[model samples]
Target chain A: MVHAEASTFAEGLSKKQVYEQVLGQAQALFDGQRNWVCNLANASSLLYHAYHSLPSPSNAVNWAGFYVLDPKNPKQLILGPFHGQVACQTIAIGRGVCGTAVEKKTTQLVEDVERFPGHIACDGASKSEVVVPIFQDGRVVAIIDVDCAELSGFTVEDQVALEHVAELIAKSCDF
Target chain B: MVHAEASTFAEGLSKKQVYEQVLGQAQALFDGQRNWVCNLANASSLLYHAYHSLPSPSNAVNWAGFYVLDPKNPKQLILGPFHGQVACQTIAIGRGVCGTAVEKKTTQLVEDVERFPGHIACDGASKSEVVVPIFQDGRVVAIIDVDCAELSGFTVEDQVALEHVAELIAKSCDF
Candidate 1:
């Protein structure tokens, strides 16, 4: 799975440049790929590479990553490739909004950090957050996420983007 | 499933503005509720209201949607709910780049229409396109789609928006 695909992603790209690259690549890949999971993985890897190392590039998000569903266990979405200081490899289906998304079978966009039940503090600094569900057979299977150090960092533009992507998943995912 | 949830939304918002309102509602519901399927379903309904009968709005995308994975079938992205039409219900995973995205598990930025294989002509005039994947368990389960009637209709900003939602699905999915 570790291919030399992202090599041209600019080892020399600055943090700001990296973020711009991530953003650019995000648009490019999405327009080019039109597939949600692949784009999700790509976006997660790009952001992870930029942010996972903390004191990361200026543009990298503080904490960002994805937890995918196991084909063997559709009940939970295990943390897959991401960008941030570290990763949360395990999350149950009904535990938090992220997990509850599966149980609830819907996208959960949390604007306030303090109110969520079972919220994991992987990054205590993350204030506002958003989670969109990936569905199959009218069922919740996985979730996509973005966390920011700033409270209410998630925006209208951001919601539209995420929701649009979620919309795509709902349509094309026949797996 | 068809509750009068967005009746208010329908009253105040223009057809084009409906997408934005739905996105806003979707974001709030994400943070506040656990009805994952309902959340997405509602979002789809808003989009359907916004552009379904309109003449593909000007200055913005006319319609947008996604596909989901079906446990029983891995070869196609079963169209779930969308903002435009219902005919795009079943698209083979390998027929078009959208399908190939499932095949490659990679994002595709297509600037031209005739280039992709099995490209379902949701909007035959659509020139440029973007496909982002929704993943669960390191495997692609769906795709996010944004189509414009104009060729090369997408930009970096659009990509950012689409990917954000895509990530939301990846993170908020039941997984």
Candidate 2:
């Protein structure tokens, strides 16, 4: 495995590297990695898959995943994999980051984390965040999420990267 | 366009019927036919889509969209879809129907609702449910849910139907 400086991942990060890293991590974990559940839980599978497939590293801030617990209930959004600090659990359908994400049914790549309201502090240090809803049979079952320490963690490239992740999620669900 | 009694759907209800019904309903709300999202939210989507395409449904389930929500956060997965009647929005990573589903990372189709423990009561009326996870890339991002107001709302056909839906979701995601 290749070790990259956080700084190297910070500036001019290529999407390929991001995706490769995530794939590598997933492959390693899948190759009997320890406490697989620790990383696999909370949409980490989607996160690892999406993160590695991205084409631009600069867009890492926007990488994330959101899932649902009960779509018929409209009460919560499931937490998935992320690139930055974030809550590791459910979000109400009409409440904070998860709630707003559900309410809008659209992906939000927050540029400034401080300005956002009701931001869950899984990693209190995290600033920017991105969220995307997971739709089931026309209804949103969950969402894709991402968090970043940088204010401008998300960008068009990040959005594009997630779109690919979303597509990957959309395709690989054959259980 | 077609409103068949839920019971009628039980008797060889063609997957095409499910797809048509799902898309028809989605079109009523959204602007277009993004079959992948609308279909995969529930395992029925796969069954229905396959029915539409192959005129035959496969036996599969999609699980990934939903998660057990953190009560303190009250945002994400509290339980899995196709669950029994209980307050399941706050299930742990490996408890109850939701947790069991995540632990296995596969669809759990209960034949009898009364037999299952940790059943949530979003609708006590439902006797049977099918929960399928939706995947983006290789990770679970959402789940396809199917519930029968009666016992055994799902079948092998239903399983295939929902898996088709999961495929659509996987295709639509950003990964």
Candidate 3:
């Protein structure tokens, strides 16, 4: 059973503190569940609500979700679990921020999505975005994509925190 | 490209009208995407946000999501894409409302979840629930589950509309 308490962040915590709480809660949630479908579904919910519980710009997050590498198509990503508005269904390996993260095998943190070339506008309200590739056995399995309605919504600290999350997901789930 | 406009329901539209809009937008969203992962992900988002765009009790919905039949374990339903709080990872067929939908091959509409025997509490705030089975061939492929914060949150009208949505999903995507 997933407790509502798990998704509710305590008030007055710093962004880093909130993320630390999320990581701990996520670890506990994934203790015996290795299915990517279940894990990603819960992970997106946890992150989405956690951010909303925060103050200001963090609360401006418009989308937080996953796009997994299509098993039959090695070069394409299909939408996975998410907590947001309707989104793009498929994205190629080198098209948008999500694709660029996979192609580069590194996280792409764009302070302003409009400034980024070839940015796929899934949600017009999204002003900034971050994509973190999840790898397994030296191959990318999925990418975590988060978008916010405010410019420069994410900083280096967010990238570092989310990258840790990506690493945890890569190890905790079975693609 | 998925426009944010596809998710925002117009004000003062009746519940039936809202669902009609959702079904139309969902069809447009799934026009080219046949992958269940992508379709279900977007479908849940469309339902969740559409419900919230309504007024008062109708907006009390807390969860809208899918649970797919486990490929490896045919007797179980694994969590799929959703727009809600963290949820149960797996439910054996015939257990919860979702499982019962699969077991009985019919929709389960509970006025109050607390009164349902063997009800699964994924989100504590959820008071009423509805689960509609999505079928392909002669077997259940997935189930659409929605929860609301008020008792008797759904009516016969809701079940009828959602069943239509379920049938549309059954024909539009590949599991």
Best by TM-score: 3
Candidate 2: segments with Cα more than 4 A from true spot: A1-13, A16-65, A71-73, A80-88, B1-175
TM-score of chain B of each: 0.70, 0.55, 0.97
Tens-place lDDT per residue, model 1, A1-175, is: 1122341354554444544555555555455344444455445555544443334222334545456675556665665433333334456788766777677766666776778988877556667677777666766655767777666655564555565555554554333
Give i-RMS (Å) per prediction.
Answer: 16.2, 18.1, 1.2
Cα lDDT for residue A86, candidate 1: 33
State, as a TM-score between 0 and 1, how close model 1 is to the true structure.
0.41
> Mind giving the per-residue lDDT tens digits that candidate 2 earns over A1-175?
1111111223344665665445444344333222211223323433533443444333344334345454334475543333222233345676656678778877777877667787655555556777665554655655666666567766776666565555444433421
Better of 1 and 3 by DockQ: 3
Q: DockQ for each candidate?
A: 0.02, 0.02, 0.79
- In CAPRI terms, where does candidate 2 land? incorrect
CAPRI grade of model 1: incorrect
Candidate 1 per-residue lDDT over residues B26-131, each given as its tens digit: 5654553233333343344443344333343323454455667744467766554343321243567777757877788877777776777667675555677777
**Candidate 3 local distance difference test against the native:** 0.90
Best by lDDT: 3
Ranking by lDDT: 3, 1, 2
